[model samples]
Target: MAFLELHDIHKSYFLGKEEFPVLNGIDLDFELGEFVSILGESGGGKSTLMNIIGGLDRNFDGEVDVNGQPLDHKKEKQLDDYRRGTIGYIYQSYNLITHLNIVDNVLVSLNMTDLSKSARKQRAIELLQKVGLGDQLKKHPNQLSGGQKQRVAIARALASDPEIVIADEPTGALDSKNTAEVLELLEGIAADGKLVITVTHSQNVANHGTRIVQLTDGKIGEDTRLKEAYPTNDHQPEFKPKILSAGASYRNAFQHLSYNFWRNSLIMLGTAIGLFAVLLFSGVGNGVNAFIQDQINSMINPNSITVLKNPTGKNLSTTELQQSLSQYSSNPSKLLLSDHQINTLKKVKNVDKVEAGYQFSAFTVSYNGKNNSGQSLQTWTKAYASDTIKTGHAPKNNEIVIDKSQAIALSSQKKYKSLLGKTVKLSFAWVDKNNNPVQVTGNLKIVGFANGGQAGAITATNYSTMRNLLNNANGATQANFASVNVKNADKVKSVSKDIRNTKENNKYVFGAITVGDILDTVNQYVSIASIVLASIAGISLIVSALMIIVSMYMSVSERTKEIGILRALGERKKDIRRLFTAESILIGLFSAVLALVLAYAGSLALNHVLYGIVKFNMVQITWGNVVFTFVMAIVISFLAALLPARRASRLNPIDALSAD
Candidate 1:
């Protein structure tokens, strides 16, 4: 049986339903140890035929058999295996990976092999020696002479121990001396019992082959034995190039990609930042949401039902009952929530606890014996009915708990020496619309302090004290509204709904919400802010993708000649595609890792400053963020690399070789 066989191969193209035949009824056979040359004019389908035979193109009808195994359309893996293991190709331009050493270029063919590293290295050295390139093993292809590069290309072809070596215009780019040297090498390969095939238009190269095949208009014109072919010594031994180990392909890809690091580094950095922003924002959103939920869970009674006094929108004209409340609205004060109303609300179903709190404009407190001259020293005033003490304990009858801010203020005055047990007096005069000031003082012992240091110097007393202070001067019995705390956490929502539905006329209850609902609402607010910031960060990443596309496209253009060479050297289109993708993916991966590192550093710095401002450690960096960022980087890289890879795969070897 012949080592290789081609039976009546036919290939065509469809241009708007018009058929263009590229190859027609071409049949050929070759045995081991034969040197053959194919000669044809330009545009005669020589490259296309070579592409099909090398498994780079499969759009054809023919029976191509090697070693008695018929190439089947349904068995693409079989064809790929045959190309990978049984055929070696040499290109006219010497398609060596520019970034890799000569030995690494040869080792690329061993990517799927099971050979050990040392064994592969030994075999690579042997092949290099056979190709007269032993001294150039560690040198990159750009540093080699044209003839030396061809020698390296030949060595690479022998890497996989293939029985056949196919050369497409092996001497097309060389001078006469180099041409003779490369043609002589081909003769030696054929003499060593390997079937050597060359596609050339040069008579000298054709004269070296054992047989000459002439092609015209995509069909075989002649297949003749070349009796005048160059003679070679019959004793030369076959060269076996090193086969790469299983993991060697990735290493080779890294080495090949390394040369272009400067171009791709920024792409990686951009992608990493984009990935990091996604993960960091997600993590922060989740963390803040969880913390807010927990904070509400702690501060609010497990069974608290809150009733809002006013709707989020204005609906004052909707009810007659609201008219009765017109007086409160016209001259209403922000300090409206009342403790007496809270007691009334406690009568609702399943109510175990009741409280009222009101928020008023931040008012100035005298500090260091001097009140801040303007609103600059102002802090928000929040008065709770009871049990809002942050540290120490809640005040008893005739006692008060002031915030750390208030304590600091009094200490600064030097009238009160220390904070722990110091008494600080906060004086405020109640007034009516007539501007009549009514003096009220509930002198009490200081029991505890609020945690927000120097920010909220709050003074907490019993509900009755605050109420008396408000009504005696302001003349209002009930203010804002109330909260009814249920006995069970689950019953809080149910009770809130019941209270709102108690009477048909009670639709003016404004709004009702449980503790959990309030927490969720607060967290949603925080999430929206984070998402907006993250979205802003996301725009920068899209720019990175654009950069990646530009970089890959440039790479494709720059490596056109190399790509053509690889195609002629038995690299399938998919292989070329993967090579491009590998480079892009590596850049993305690097960017992702760097972004994560930067984000982590940023979070730490933010946490340090924000904890001081917010009085809590809410910033948290989690493992989920790191993993998510890394994955995002990879996905972005794949997306960025897709178009470039496709372009690389579809590149025409002929046009590529012609590109500058």
Candidate 2:
């Protein structure tokens, strides 16, 4: 029985519904270890018959039988398996992938087999060595001569150890000497128990085969056999099916990318710039939030809530409400908290204690012949007591905690530190019940100095001292603000909220301010600014994605033949897609890594410069941002490669092999 058979094959091409027959009623049978040449003129269907026999052309009415089993050409997967496991093809043009070296080109075919990677590589090297190009295994196709490239093609074809070898005009581009060398190689393959079939127009090429079949106008005109077939080799190597692994695919992608390192690096730089901006802005936002919290916690007691008059039901607009609150705090007026209100605040939940405080916008402090006018004075309270003191201690009953600047103004020789133990005169004016101007004066010892007093001297006196002074001048002694303290810092927010929501006289009671609330508001604004900045940075990412899409499409166009070579090697369409997609992912991964490194370095430099002005790290990168940036890079790259990958996977293997 014949090892292979072609029965009643018919093929045609259609040009606008007009059919041009290429093959008609072709019947052929072949056994192992035979060299057969299909000889014909141009357009006489020699190449078309080779295409059918190689399983590249399936649009024909024919039954191709291997060992009595007919092939279903309509099933693409079956055709793929048949080509992969049964036949090896050698094209006249070589069809070598430009990016792969000689050994790698041969390895491409062996990769479809289940051999270990080391074993596959060993086989590829052996095949290259057998072709007499062992020393040129690392050379690219463009670096080789015509004969050397043809030898590499031969090595690649036989690397898979297929049962049949089909050569289409194998020596069409070679000289007479190189042609004889390739023909002798084909005869040697036939001697090794593999069927060698060559299609050509040359009578000399046909003479090297054991049998010759002549085709005229898509029909066989002659069938002749010169000798009996050789016996099949009993020790042919067997190959199990294997699919390409992701790691191998990525390795190939890295090699291809490295081949054009400068170009790919430029693309990576463009993408990294976008990712760097996003990560930097996110880090800056984090730093700003941390800095604000640190400042607030340092200046105020975290367990204390400041209570002010709730000016809500005053029929004021938003701007008017702000003005009213400012005016009420700055001037001594009806906004002052009465004793009833103070006791009510002290009764609220989580309120450990309530400290009533009075504030005067303008006052005078004098010592000897020196005087500091237009100073602000506040009655000492527990919340304000948390501030750091430069000397002495917090104010006692008849003592004052004056600002460092005020002490300097009242000092004899402008020695502020030395004036801490000196006595100072405090004076202010107020309106009596009859609206009469009354003056009050007193002498208090300066006990301590406070920081941040450039605008005016912020002097703190005991609450009783300020109350007594107001009483002497017939002025109101009501406290304008109250500080409600909670036992635990964690309960400050809840306690503050409850105080602000409390009601009295059918109106909302007091407006509450907690350090946590202020920090939250400031942080919220910082985050919004960061998001806006990052979004602006994201425009560059979109542009980068478009650039990658164009780059991948160009790659598809340039590697069209490589795609064909892989398909002919038994790669599925999904494999082709994965190949292109993997390349894109590698590009993205490289860009992301570059961006992260740049951002971190930039942050370090910025923080170094900023720390001199403000003792804080100005940029803080978190693990979340790092993970998010990498995920963004991968997802965007995958999405960008979709169209190009699909186009590569859907390419016609035959047409692709024929592309320039």
Candidate 3:
């Protein structure tokens, strides 16, 4: 069987709704250790024929068999394997990877093999030496001379130990001396029992081949064999390097990118910025949420159910409050809950305890004789109080317990010894029903301080005593509402619902007791804020994504020559697409990481600042966010690169190669 055979192969492409034939029923065959050169002028389809033979174009209708294995029309992977395993390719432009060193460029062919790194490196070095580039291991392609670069390309072509070597104008870019040198290298390659096929217009290069074929209008015009085609060797040569290994491929990925990092650093920088934003936004949002949750957990009593009057005036106060008492006061007719409602609410489902309370004032306090105005503490008065006191016990029926600041105001001193247990005469007056001043006197004792405030301490007073005092001083009911605690805090919502179900118009009478509701309110607000902020910042990210798409498209355009070279070197269309997609994914990963970092830092800062005002820890960055953002960014980037990748893969290698 012939080492390589092509029978009646025909190829055509559509241009402007017309079929333009590039190659017409071409037949050719080559044996092992054969050196042949196809000489043709521009537009003669010499490059097109080479492209088809190299498996770059599977569009041609013909039989292309190598060692009796027929080529498949749809099996792009098999064609890739054939190119990778059976063919060594050389290009006139000296197609070398700019991102890798000379040795690494050659070793790329062996990256997917099963060989160890040391072995691959050694093999790469040997190939470089065989191609007369022994001392340029660390040199990038851009740093090498034209002749030197071509030599490196030749070494790379031979790196995988392919059985066939195909050269397209291998000496086209070389001077006379370098051309001869390259031709001699090709002859040597063929002598080593590999078929060497070169397409060139140079007679000197053709004369060096064992056989020469001339082409005109996509058909072979002449085929001639030289008289002395073989040169006898005295000894067998050493073993060449094999294919790439899986392990080597991993290392090569990192090494390959690192080698070309300088050229692509700007892209990475852009990616890092995008990642930082996403991370920062998500981190800060989570942190704020955590902080709010923590604050709610600490401030509200475990068994407490907060009550608020409905602004819509939908339900009367007595109905829900009565049910909350568990006293079976399920009367919608008596919707308004009065003092009698408080007594009934104490018996509701899950009714462990009850404390009726209301806020009186939130103004700055002032002493009769003091230098500065009191810290604006909210004054709370409750009919029943379940607050945990830090220093003193609960007050008696008429006695009042004041915060440390209030005690200091009455005593004109701040020390605990002077403030505590001191019979401080506190006098204040309230307007009566007729708008007359009713002077009141009360003995104030500093029970304790809840938390220090620069202005003043938030103060609490006995609900009954404050009520009596206010009623006497202002001639009105001091305690306007009530508070209730359920047996199980977790069941507060269910019990509250049951309480309301027993009444209709009186739903407004009772307040639903639920810590979960309060927490949900906070979270709802946070979510809204996050959405707004994300939208604002997301506009910028969208712009960046669009920019990324533009950048990838430009990359596809710029790398046409490289893509063509890879195709000629046996890269399938899918492989080309993967390479482009991989590049886009790398870009997205960088962006995601940057976003995460920024989110983390932003969360930390946000938590620190918001903790002061809200008295809560806000935001917790989760691992789920990191992984999600990373995957999302990568998927988006990959998707963005898809169209361009496909465009590149489908490009005609001959056209790409011929482009300036």
Rank list by lDDT: 2, 1, 3
Instruction: For candidate 2, list the clashing residue pairs, or say none.
Output: none
* Number of clashes recorded per candidate: 6, 0, 47
What does candidate 3's lDDT look like per residue over 1-660, in tens digits? 577899998888898899988888899988878899999898888888887777777788888989888887468777777777777889898888676788878767866445666887898999898888888888889999889998998898887777788899999988988888898899888888788999998888888889998988878889888843454334332443333333443354355446556655666566556556656666667767776555445445656664533322344233444344444223211222456666667767787766665443232333445422332322342322344345666565554455565555555554644555544444454444454556654544544544333323555556666667666555444334456677776787776665544443654444564557656766788878776776676666666667667876787787787777666555667767777777777767766766676677777787789778766556567898788778878877788789988998898776776666
Worst 10 residues of 2 by lDDT: 313-322
Local accuracy of candidate 1 as per-residue lDDT tens digits, 240-300: 3322232343464576567777766767766777777876787677668766765554434
Relative to the true structure, candidate 1 reaches a TM of 0.71
Which candidate leads the pack in TM-score? Answer: 2
Per-residue error for 356 in candidate 1, Å, reads: 7.2
lDDT at position 122, candidate 1: 85
Scored by lDDT, model 2 comes in at: 0.85
Between prediction 2 and prediction 3, the one with superior TM-score is 2
Q: After superposition, how far is residue 259 of candidate 2 from its true place, in Å?
A: 0.2
Q: What is every candidate's alpha-carbon RMSD to the true fold?
A: 7.1, 4.1, 6.3
Winning model by lDDT: 2
For model 3, the superposed segments whose C-alpha errors exceed 4 Å read 11-24, 40-43, 59-61, 72-78, 112-119, 227-278, 281-298, 307-351, 356-393, 403-446, 452-457, 463-482, 486-509, 595-632
lDDT values, one for every candidate: 0.68, 0.85, 0.67
